[model samples]
Target: MASGAEARDRLAQTAMYDRVESALNLVNERKSGLTVPNKWAFEARVGGSVSGAQLAITWSRRNEPEATLYLNNDVEPELAAKTLLDRTYGLIAASFADRIIGRDGARDVSASMLRRVANRLNELYTGRFDEIIHGQSLPLVSIDHLERAGPNPFLYHARTGEVLGDFTGLVRQALDRLIQRNRLRIEDVDVGLLASLFRELFSNTHLHARTDLEGALYRRSARGIVFALRPVDIPHDSFAAGLPVLKEYIESMEREAARPRVEFLEVSVFDSGPGLAARTLRSVVPADLPIEREYELVQKCFLKTYTSVSNPAHGWGLPRVMHALKSSGGFMRLRTGRLSLCKWFPPGMKDPRVTADDLQFMDIGGGSPKRHARVEGAVFTILIPVGLGN
Candidate 1:
């Protein structure tokens, strides 16, 4: 086995190299020339994928297309390049989105246009998550109880623009350390996935729902930061479908004891706000869909972007979460409406059978009546199976 020091070194090197490559890739794509004073200089800066994934970008402006350029002493050879690139892209996209939408509350643009901008930001930051850590070494550790928050056990911190961007890396690193310490073996865990979900939910709250509640979610405790995923009561059908999928997952695990044993899986997410219509509730989780497929829909929640936040330049968490859950044998269960939106999964998917009632009701639309829920707050519950894929 590699010594801890050796492992740490290798990991750091790999991450750095990745950052360098990402920076170079961005440069290769957009080779813009810059004029600084009269000392015309040219630079071909590069960033590794690690840096890019951390939302870092590097660039060199040249007096000429091919003039020799010198990196300033102020710049960290690696980070300066990546951060510059990432920041440039963010500003450009935000500016464009703002212009099209009319920063002064103009409704001149279509929703689709806004979505494109949001996806752009997601692409930019998704890769550069490491940039936020500033080369700090956080040894991997895994523990438990990262989930659960009284009635609502999830984190929600609504911040705007630069503040949001500043925290992006910090939040990602913090969650990374948290998951590392409480490593879940039965499922794949990633800070990007969790951060994306939390960010999206928080953005929605700030844009549409009640934004006054500061400590509502993502509360800092002596133990650490805590996010509460509350279970709101939504409409429900007498019939619940999708129990079979949970049953099958558990049964399959029991049959394959070699696989990591899962303690449980709990998913709590919302699409629409309260005061949902009866029709919306009845259709939340479809009745005809199989239990497993129904669960798949819940998993899809994270896949959705665009309207989660009013701004198109900033929605990506749900999709990231969806991708993360796909790898592990984990799944999500959701219920949306005035009754609530809830999801649950357990390790190995055994014993606890999803009853007919649990499998019958399917609310395909969450609380969204005609369009995206007018009330803009969402909640999610992410439960990882203990002792699995830590």
Candidate 2:
């Protein structure tokens, strides 16, 4: 017979796993609608809601729950906004067809923010706005599409040179803003390399994200490159406990800095399609494959010469991005399918080139890989730290 303490510990663990599994099923299993719990438990569940809400909007069926979001009164507008704003959650929720209902006259701040951003995204997608809206004032050159482009259409209508130049310019501007805000100094060469990194990421989405697993164009999908800036303070203890791999890198940055926190310009490119492993393997990943095998398949994507496409000349993108991050001492987190992996590069590392082995399963504040929920699409978040300015 288990003691009371043991019973409580088991219950806690079960709750954690249940939360993770619920989020996964909400996205992957195609539930009728989303019911967002109160704000306290929302953070753990919102990631799944993002994808699930998008699915609800795009995959609506007759006689189904009206693709609605049922909200509770304990939720705050700002918390809901912030959670939805992370990655593509806000956009997906805004695109939802049915109403977002709040119980007991609770304010639906999420609905308002979603609508605002959805309008902006539509404007940007239709070329009415030259830049995308991150918030009310931050205009970024981004691409967001709620509907499918025609079959085999050009991903970007602009000329390759022009699009690349626009993307590079936006990246440079974003980095400049980060530098000014954080009083950081970055070299011109580094700025250009970072710009290239984003360009390649956007290019990658174009190459791999337009179709379903069977190569048919998706009738409805959410795909885009979005940017946001966040200030993060990873206390020494937390770093040591949860993310020891980044310890050296964080320490090196904080050595002479006045504050321990680092400001990161987050660049996230997400797409609703078959995820990285599925696309790389050109088939659905076997459901029974060990987690280790799944991790290996994701790592294979960063190999120096990996091309899921047919062209022999087009396999260097991911490796180049890896090398650039290693050189710039940046951090990246990739969530796709059942894997959440990350790699950190400290400045002046002995081997500037990243290999597949360097990728590790991300520790989600639990010191283990068990917390990861399967994401329907691929989401890659690249965090480039802004250093203290001279």
Best by lDDT: 2
lDDT of 1 by residue, 261-282 (tens): 4333232332222212212122
lDDT of each: 0.30, 0.52
Q: Highest TM-score among the candidates is held by which one?
A: 2
C-alpha RMSD of each candidate structure in angstroms? 22.8, 7.7
> RMSD in Å for candidate 2, one decimal?
7.7
Task: Provide the global lDDT of candidate 2 against the true structure.
Answer: 0.52
Candidate 2: stretches off by over 4 Å:
1-22, 25-32, 35-66, 71-87, 96-118, 122-166, 176-180, 185-189, 233-252, 256-261, 355-371
Model 1: lDDT to the true structure: 0.30
